[model samples]
Target: MVTKGAMLWLACTYDLDGGTLGHLRWRDEEVRTVILAIPTSTPQCSTSFPDNYRIDCNLASNEVRLGILNPVHGDTYTCSVYLSDATLKGWVLTQVSIIVPVPNVTLTSPVSDTVTVTPGDSQVYTYVTGSCRPPARIDWYKDGVNVTNQTGSVSNDGDEFVTTSSFTLTGAKDDRPATVQCRASNVDGMTPVQSGVKTLVVQCPPEIPTNIQEMENTETTIIVQWTEGFNGGQPQTFVILYRPEGGTKTETVSVIEQQQSTYTKEITGLIPNTRYLLNMYAYNVVGNSSLSSVVDIISKTNQECSYKGEMTSIPNLASIALFITSSVLLVTAVFLVMCIICRRKLRKMRGRENNPVAEAGVNLPLSPVGQHDISTERSHYDDLNLEEREPPSNYECLGSNAAANVNTQASTDDRQMYESLGTRSNAAVYDELEGPASRAHVII
Candidate 1:
């Protein structure tokens, strides 16, 4: 076998006395008849052939030679010789098989250098080899790795064979922007021709957001932050879903800023001293990713008290003001009541000092009938015992002057006893009543 565009020669020889080389035929066509034939003497003849072919006849050597400048496959040459004895004749034939190296390789299906495809989708790439002999062998490659597992088909268009190879590529996230190429080889020991690189861009949803956490929080607001994941070859946005723990209602917020390594969002309108559950999701044009790991966060408490898993809000300004006003009023009322009581006791003591009849009745010993009357009277004055008492007119005084002196003595003794015991008892009662007023004043 010879390569295309190479020189090839075919010769046929005969050993017959008085024989001459007649003519050469290629593929059942006489070479001299198709082009120009040069007649020569008995020793030699020549022909000019078509398509860069030459024919020579040598009667001395009894050989005929056919010269092909650009040989192609499926070419046949036949030489016929005539002997001097007409009964003997012979012919010789030679067939040509030429190797056609692959000329050009190109991707026909994906004409452009780059193609965009969705993940999990299939893409077909077709590689065609230029017309060649002995049909070229086609191989597929992805990212410089050999993946030539599929068979190829070859068809003859006139004289040369064209090889077509198709490779199906499945789009994947990990293999994004993969480079695919096709190589064609026809001749042994010859380097294969490769098509231009075709880049496969696999577009998919963004990856799940990671490392979600609470950055800061206030009574009604929380600031959340997270590490952004792969955007899947496109711009992506993040969504946050938050809800109070064990609550049925859910709220959502979105972060629309582009191309951030770390994303942050502030969530407002939250309840204080409440536990919240949160999750994040990434979204793109293709689709949304799965929700990220759940995050547990708690909002800060206001002026609140927590007791036994229960929360109570502190009183507001109005309630505090009302409480202070009520305490002040109560303290004033208690002070006024104590002052009225002290003033009434002072008035009764002054009346007892001015009237000697009431003073004498208080110190005088009583008969059974008088004692009963006194007891009945004392019962009506049980709280203060300050009611006016008149001495019995039937009881005789010692004499005017003697009675005056005795009365004076008795008044002195009673005054001494009252000053000793009555003063102490009154002071004790006053102290007991004053304790509450002092405490109320302090509270006010």
Candidate 2:
């Protein structure tokens, strides 16, 4: 376009450089001249090329020198040449169309090779332009598909047009990089100018963890484990929900943020010997995911013990029978030990009672009344034998052998004499006999 007060020139020439027609004079019949010129910026009654050009009809060349070209200069130029005469209508005509230049597209904001974005964040993909005539239309494509969440503006600086298109990207989706591009187009009908692909890196939460396992169990707790799928390109944590089976309320446990394949947790504060229901979920920047499948678990029960402090379980019928048998055996062992100890004590007492010293004290022998005198007159009595035997005093002897011996030793005269003695004297004579004869007692 030609601006007011700008110099401009318009010439009607066609492939005639150094040719025969090139040397033709401006008024020659074969030479062409501008028949019409239009500047759309001005009114029809006014000069269309007002002060912007000059018509120099010299002897050799007829040329129009322009001051400046602006948007008003974007008009069709028509030229004509007469074949026979200037007044005749037989002529060859030509036209020239002028327009703005094509645009150069550029990606301004995402200057680096790739742009990172997360879910729920508003990202701006800005497209700008270098100097261009006839401002271009900016279109955005995401993964080869056109996008509409965008805006555009165009401004001209007299010599060139500037265009800017900003695409605000926002949506909920899985984490993945997307290919994005911006292209510019205009009236020049040339190939569309485009910017290189700018990758959109997305981050979001992972899927629910699966394959929950009850690894270990105790009287008051359980050890649970699980496996996790993709992490959605972000770090994640886990939440575990647990409760007694068929109970109304539930308990919650959480795992610290992580991105590993497998995880484990110790779930405590549980009732002993109770059954439980449980599930797990994964958490990331976005939010928690759907709960995983429910699982069943049973807390361990306390173990019982026997009276001897041996560990045991609640007794079944068979176990009761076995316990009774064991009790009987233990009782029998205790009784046998007691009996053996009693027998040992009795044997020791009987041995002490049968000692020879005890028997000697129970049967002590007694001495005769005249045992001292007998010992001193032993030789005299032995020499005098029967004639010198002395009479005993006071007590009567009840020994049969002594009586028999006295009767046998006594003569007829002695018997008559002893019989004449009184009963008292006879008893006194028998009292003195003792020794082995005392064991055989005869009471007269």
Candidate 3:
């Protein structure tokens, strides 16, 4: 395939029509020179190719015989057809080449042709910006003012330039015709050829969760619950902090990203009955957390309180109010029922509900008033107990009182059954305990 001139060693192939049209591509369509030359000079094929390479080409035959030719011979001419010994005509043919234009562009964003963004708030804007060439620069503008954000770098994907522009709102005031226009140009400092603008609807930040509740009393656990996080986009992580009483330093308790709709953390080694400052931050990747809400945890046995807020899923204020009303009624009903059962038990012991803690072993005579008998154990209940009690612990007892009502009806055997259920299964509501002794409940 070596040559004296600048011709490349392009392919050289020959096709004979067998049953279909053969495929052949030639750069220079002009036939240089062809001959119907009969091979009589060589004893056989001097070049070792088929001898029919010279004398076989039929233009009229739908199926014809064809062969290749060697271009190595000198410029002299000796042309003759095979069998007939006639000279073949040497004519030139030309081929034309054409390229089609690209189709119309497609718009991927702003389905309604307008986008609504907030002022001073940053939002990541994305688009499939494509063109004949790479984009020089892609910028998103609003109302002729540049919408700024944390812009990521763009790379060429096929015939498109991909970039995510963070749209920051220094002042995305209410009802403003906020426009998100993605301008894409091929070269830097050039005019944007394909651009789209969408109107933005800017609003205030979502309201923070109300009525934060903290579970304390256990020397090693803290449970925080609130109304569901802002029901806008996906939920964000919860950042919690703990500051001991009388101390200014604070420690981050946890950063919960997934399953942030609810939060419950078991903090070990916390002091019993001591008050700790609690703060909760609800956030997501795209938005900052709502204002930090404060709560004080008081470790106590089965403490409960009502959380304040309207539910997000429900639409009717009346329904929400009705729900709150019903919940209160239910709690009050249980409290009354518990008060009844507790009074009956106290009557059996012939004791007051508010008996002093020091009276555990101070009585003169051991007595039984009814079938319900009060028997004193030989040793103190706290002495042999391995579990640590968070005496003096402070917490928002959201469910404790109601739970006490439910638990009071159950016997010690029932409590054991519930404890087994709580430990065997994952920590769900089943793990929550009731009554004054419930604060001692731990996972293990």
Best by lDDT: 1
Worst 10 residues of 2 by lDDT: 357-366
Clashes of 2: 18
Off by over 4 Å in 2: 1-103, 110-118, 148-151, 187-189, 205-279, 283-296, 299-336, 343-352, 355-444
Candidate 2, 398-435: lDDT as tens digits: 13333554443333333343343333342333343332
The numbered model that scores best in TM-score is 1
Which lDDT tens digits does candidate 3 get at residues 97-126?
A: 111111123355446664434446555445
TM-scores of the candidates are 0.51, 0.43, 0.25
lDDT, model 3, position 361: 22
Error of 2 at 92 (Å): 13
The lDDT for every candidate, in the order shown, is 0.69, 0.57, 0.43
**Considering lDDT, where higher is better, how would the candidates rank from best to worst?**
1, 2, 3
Tens digit per residue, CA lDDT, model 1, 1-444: 778878887776666655443333333334443222222443245443457767665545556567778765676666665543444366666778888889998778977788878778889999888998778998899999998744389899787889988999998766658899988888778998888898888888899999899998877899998988777767888999999999999899998747568888899999887999999898999889999988999997766655688877876577899999999999999999999999999977864544333443432222223334442244212223433444335332222332444455554543444344334554453343244322221110
